[model samples]
Target: MSQREQAILVVSASTDVIDLIFDLCEQCQEASLRLLVVRNTDEVESVLEHHEISLAIVDCSTFTDVEYLNQLAAHLSPMSTMALLEEGTAEGMVAVLRNGADDVFSLAELHLHPQLFIGSLQRQLQRVRMIEEVRFLRESLERSLDELKADQHAAQQLQEKLLPPPVRELNHIDFEYVLQPSLLLSGDFVDSIAINEYQTIFYLADVSGHGASSALVTVLLKNMTYRLVRNYNRNSSFDIQSPLATLHRVNRELLLTGLGKHLTMFIGLIDERDSSLTYAVGGHHPMPVLAQGGEVAFLEGRGMPIGLFEKPVFDERRIALDPTYSITLFSDGILEVAEGDSLDEKEQVLLAACGGKNLSPQSICDFIIPAGRVNPDDVAIMTVSRV
Candidate 1:
């Protein structure tokens, strides 16, 4: 049965009036009616607490004041109400409607014909059920969205744990980095690990896209890097320091599964003994300028990105590290910043940030990043310096 046709509630202030409604409710054939005689405002709250009242047939003859009627309307639920009125002015009828009554019934007409009252009450109850159903659905959707948001937050935290945190005081090298994700799970990833006592390796990679899918690929890359590093330690032929060979292996593995996947990456290994830095690029953005004494020089890569073409030649670039120079490896998101007058303008701003007399990696990043571009895509920046 419809919720409207299940049960009803009858409210009246006077004992005689209550008895009259109880008798009429018994006579009605449509649905069952539950009667509650509310002597005053004190009983309204108590009655509502225990009983699931659907429709209220309020006694309007005794509860005639606007304030009392308004109190009942305010305490009751919205969208389902039936007002009882005496044969009076049109203003009284309008007042009942303005107070949120679905329909106002005349007491005289109700006594003259019982069928009309039953039919009108039944119609109002049907409307009440419809509104209740909509309200139920809306609440359910809100709860589901809240749960999804909470799950996403948990996933983001787990993804962060997978990322390698910055290592402080790595022998003779001074480094700093920043990672800002556009979404809860970012596609950009960075890591720094020591290959041996004399060589420390670092790589910055941007997956093909953003969000959870790209984040999963980044986790896979990290695991692969870990496995390869271990292999290099155990065997002499792995060439752990060769960035090009690493990219080639990663590219082949990603393409084998036909995942339509690819990555832009820059991998670097620092030889602490001679301060020589060997690096390779995989279709990543051009390297940042190596800034020294207010001058800038290009550090361009000579290879295509990984996972695009098979047997792609990976070119490794090397530079002798200078205590006076800073080597920056960054994602395209920084260069793609939209607020600048031009790409040159953005580059100039970044160069100026690094131009500070006592600049650190964190300080330089903080200066160059505009407020508006803080997050729109994954932005990762890493700088390596010879201390």
Candidate 2:
């Protein structure tokens, strides 16, 4: 196989300097030096455009003007500049170096240190190749990122369409909740549907994973929840009006799909007649902390997470809803928050944020999610208030 050739751009105003540069570049063991001789500095830019030129040798002996040298250095970038200086032009040599020369070579040094000159030229060529490679890779990465963003937008639109509204109005009471995904899309899904005039069933499910894969399952969950709730609400002679059964069913549906997916959920049934709350949870974290009148405690129920085992049993728990209590549920991404000067310290800081009075779900999330808590995963939070 033929090794790829390395290119060098020799820009000189003097015939003698041009000759020296060509000799040095050609003598180098593995360089394809191309002579780009221009009497004027303006021509350097045009020649650079035509050739896959890497290292640039600017002959100071050819041009008395320093501005042209500056322009050449600026256009060529820093990786490929070699300034040729006359015997007494120390000031000019310094100026070229300041502008952005890789190395300034004297006429005598070019003659005596032929190997050194060739080595410098080869290094410049290598540097230019590296720069070009990095530029190509960066542009490719940016293009990939743009395509990903477009796909993410489409996924978000699909997920939003699948979600029921944040708040649903019922006959005797109104249900309101808020959901925020840590990433472009979240695994958290919430829905509310009317079963009867006096009773409504609602639940929040946090699917495992983030991004597109986690988001696809949301559509299925939304359809299944609405259908089951609506069907149950229509029948009056139903004894299984509990959150555990709902989660159990959701688990089965998820498992049957064979997508290797699972979810942690808090499903609830609210009876408007006595303001009673019945709910079940499935291996979820940051358990619903029900708070009222400055008192807060974690809500708990027993159930294996959906889709883990073939047939899992769930426990349904009941609570009395007073005027000021609120229910909060969250995904694991919240626990994975980053903060502090280093980032990991912020997670510990959130522990303090969760402690206090007059705590609402939104408040807890806001305190924990600072501007710098950008990890690669998704975070989600949802809440329902009984007012």
Candidate 3:
């Protein structure tokens, strides 16, 4: 696993060939260059254990058979290789090169053009070093990619864990929710927190983007709402429990953080004693559907998205709920799934799906939303019903 020192490997017993390599190394002034000397194929593996052999110089006079030279060349590669033969066998260069030697040289050429021969060796060595460097960089990049994936996976698990159960109880009300993500990290989130024995505050928020940046905002939203609940429990603030005040608190915090993320959300407070739902809307589209009195209609409320402006104002809306009622809330991703040519057409389809009497959250979503879509936008669907 350890990276080895780069070197040239010369496989020969002849003192002339060995001396030629030493002379070339000195003539090139490669003071740090290391040479690995081996006499036979048996010694090749042992030398490889210590040095990263970049170039192999094989004296092919004893390996004239094409098949044997081919085998030798195969063993020396992917390191650059050169074949040396006796001067009279000039025709051997073609066979050696075709068999995969990067270059071929002769003892006669080295003697006649010493400078040119050294130049050729230098070029081959430079090429081999470049190949090794590229391989090392590729491995390092792969390791970095793996680490990023691991971190994203951990963040996704924690995000899923923070969600409420599919079926949650708060006095006379019940809550249900489902989430689908476009990627390893999602921008959509939903949760419920009990403000008191009789009041449960629930909301679904869709942050501006997908992946880690938006995911961090979802975590902030959860923490902000919890801090508000703690304030209510300590009797430090009552407005903290109101859906309108909660949106205002979140908007202020988001602006202060300067994270450049904003979200559209619908927060509701279910008062069991009054059989009423008090809620606030932060520019959430396809507003929460109210299914009561054997009919379905979109709740009427509008406001600026949170985290966008400094003096932003939102309104608190109230609607009386029947003894048996269901309120379905969806992030705008529903429109992406709803069949339509335009936003108006998609809204109509969403309304039609909710016409049934007393449909559960899962039933409403299952009817309107298709599953197994590739690269779907982040979606959070939630329903609060009296049971």
Candidate 4:
């Protein structure tokens, strides 16, 4: 396995030719060559079974079938270099070299000056060492990549566990959501939690960018929401019910983390007693669609994206919820998948999708994303309905 100890193979029919190769190898002790002497083709095959021959020296004059020797050399290690030793004329030597030999050595001249053969073997050993080093580095890189993929898969599983249930019902109101990531990790996130007996808070946020970095922000947002709920329960003065106040708290927390990421979000608080929906928008596009009494229209709200500025103001809008109404919220990724040439045309397609009878998150996803098609961005859908 060491670079200095190279495996060398010498094939010949005459015992004297094999001894000459072994003697030359011994003269070059600095090369540290391990010689494997094989007389016949069967012996060559046997030697190959036990050892990885790095350099093959074939005695062309002793072996009449140069083609067979060429085939045997080809079957050896890909890094193996071959040299032909011919005692005949230059024309015969050229013919043997053309068959497959990397270099040709005059057997008669080698007997007079063995140093010429020793120098050529040393060069072949250097080439073998370089090939082995490259092979080692390639294998190491492949192992590192495999380990990285395993870690990513584990992180994805943890993220999925943190997501809210696909379908949750609170106080006769049904909250349904679907989250699809372009990659293993998603930037879009959704959550619905009942603040009190009569109030339920739900939000869908699309963080700027995709993959692990954006996914990290979702975890921070979820933790912030939990902390906000605890604060509301402990202190009556803390206004977690207000959509604008909730956005403000989230914006401050996101900035404090210094992640340099912003998000477009639609946060809403539904009061079951009053039958009203109070919501705030943070630069979210293709607003939530409200469907009731055969009419469909986008909810009204607009503001800067969260985590962008220190004192950014968010607008809070309150609307009376119809007895039989469905409000569906979507991340901007829906527009990219929608069939349209422009934003306005895409908005129409979305409105048409939500215009008809009440559709669940699964149905909406099926309509927008065709079967056997992949999404280019992270998509999140949340539908809260009171029937």
Candidate 5:
């Protein structure tokens, strides 16, 4: 109930009971309550619906029996206290109390103890003040939550723009990817960039944590890669197309940031001229699948994760590429939902899935992500292929 609209109901057939309450209100000026005098039961119900009644003072004598008082108390609004005026026996007093009367008074003793009526009114008003304060705090909390959601949504959009398109054609090699975040922002990131004419560099990275903190690392990763490419174009560096050198440079920059974050990455350079792929692994799992000539298998390599140790070592491995082949890379999150009971069993499931689908990112996503399913962790799928 609002502070300025606290109404109190007085239900009595005689004018004496009503007069006594009015005189008590005048004597107690601290609790300013609007007095609602109603003579009958029906009038009391009407006032309760339209007014925010704080307390209801009912006269048991006006009712036919104690049953009426029982029904009235049960039907009053929640948090509204009910008091009774009954100059009857102890049996009647207990009956009225069980019927929901917070306090009972002997109407005959009012002339001797006028203070009794004043004390009860003050207590009931105190309860009303507590209710109002709780309501105000609840409303304020809801507003704060709404504002936080809005900020997260805006950050999500900017993160999406930092990466390359979902599908791209670079250096005559087709690239496609699908990234699904567990939260409003994703820790998994993917990108493909062309260097010179015959070579293309592409990578998929998974940051250590899940939400906004991990997402911030992705932004920094993209910026560092962009700076590397800019330096190469200006002839200041040649690490962009070298998988081993690129990983070392990334490790050095990530350590300098001191963001307390680490990442597992699968980075590769595809060369169409020699029909070869040179790749390096940074503590990644479910290694990229090589599908060629009706046979599919995982490539080989493992190293310490980037951004972890001061001098993390990584080795670049080369594989002979066929004229028509597809290489698929995925974040470890893919294993969480893979069809298996253990990690080894899960790896087999993924190899089987990619082998069956012939290493298509779209086909892999269809088999992995359901129409309305939310994965427990961030999932990133990327495919570098040629027909």
Candidate 6:
């Protein structure tokens, strides 16, 4: 409600009191108050039924039963202001105020100095307006929060659709992964694709931040991988099998988008016939762990983060894979939730978990992020094995 807009309902049986209120309203021209004069309780009830009142001034002397005043105060809007005019002592004024009246003034004193009553009325009206404004702002904030949740839900659905399958079998190797975001949208992404009869490619990326902006880069990364596969099929010049070339292309394209964001990644290619695994790393922490012959250790490779440098060099390392071996990759978010006093201890815990024979995406999540617990960052884990 605006400051100038208010309907003042004045209830009094005495014509002289009604006339004095009208005179006071006229004298206080800046108040811009509208008046509704009622003679008795029955008239007050009738007016309240049909119209909304902002301020109600009741003459207590005119009411035969004070219980009716309580009922009238209850029926007024929660933000409405009420003042009582009574011909009584200070104790009577306190009783009237306790009964729901915001303020109470003696009729005798009002007749002597009407300005005091007018000033009190103005203050009560101002408080009422402030309450109304606060209520409106709270309602608006709730609506915005609801809209944001809906948008985040939609984005989450889209990101899920873009995710690679949780489990896949190609040739003699098996691929499985998990992607979980601290927020509704994830910054981590994983993909595995079969390029030919003898080769398959898989990669995991963790964008710098969480939520919508980082999630968008994951989409771009997916599209870039898809386009590279298409180009590899068409032209011999495009080399999707080389992990270093794939990372370099992704870095160049991401920089071209001008998103001002960077990501750590691990891209790898598997050869089914020769049992060879070649991979490159882009500043990813807790590097991919290779488990073979009851031993687990981190892969050897390091480079600058993608989309941050123009001519960054990434090293491609190759290792012979045993018939029964597993390679596990993770985003840094897992280290954040691991229970350890130091970074080395956390890495040891992860290495132990990765070396198990029955390592799965669900197991990794359950071990790192327990039920009823929240993660501080997006978590991603991918495992490729041949057993």
Which candidate's TM-score is highest?
3
Q: How high is each candidate's TM-score?
A: 0.81, 0.69, 0.92, 0.86, 0.78, 0.88
Candidate number with the higher TM-score (2 or 5): 5
Residues 45-133 of candidate 5 have per-residue lDDT tens digits of 78877887667788877787777777777776455545555565788778888888877877765666768767766776777667767
lDDT of 4 by residue, 26-62 (tens): 8874546787887777788789889977788887665
lDDT of 3 by residue, 172-272 (tens): 68888878788899899999888888788899999998999999999999889888878888889887568898899999999998999999899999887
Residue 248 local lDDT, model 6: 92
Give lDDT: candidate 4, residue 167. Answer: 93
Candidate 3 pairs with clashing backbones: none
Each candidate's number of clashing pairs is 2, 1, 0, 0, 0, 0
Give candidate 3's error at residue 331 in angstroms. 1.6
- Give the top-scoring candidate (lDDT): 6
Tens digit of per-residue lDDT, candidate 1, span 1-387 = 234433455566667666766666676654544556676656777887887666777766666576667767666776456777767468888987787676777777668876777777768666767777887788998999899889879878888888766644466666677888888888888888788888888888988878777887788888878888999888954756788888987898888867776888888888878878888888877466576645666576767888889878777888777656666777877776534688777766776666656566556666767665556678887876653
What are the RMSDs of all candidates, in order?
Answer: 4.0, 6.5, 2.6, 3.2, 4.4, 2.9
* Model 5 deviation from the true structure expressed as Cα RMSD, one decimal place: 4.4
Clash count, candidate 6: 0
Candidate 3 error regions (>4 Å) = 1-4, 29-31, 68-78, 88-90, 357-363
**Candidates sorted by lDDT, descending order?**
6, 4, 5, 3, 1, 2
lDDT per residue for candidate 6 within 1-387, as digits (tens), equals 355467789999889888877887676635567889998877887887777677788888888776767777777756454555666687777777777787777777778888987787777777766776887789988999899999999989999999977898877679998877899999999999898898999989999988999999999999999888999898854668789999999999999999999999999899988889989988888799899988899998898899999998787899998988999999999988887889999988888788667889779768766587778998889999988
Error of 2 at 355 (Å): 17
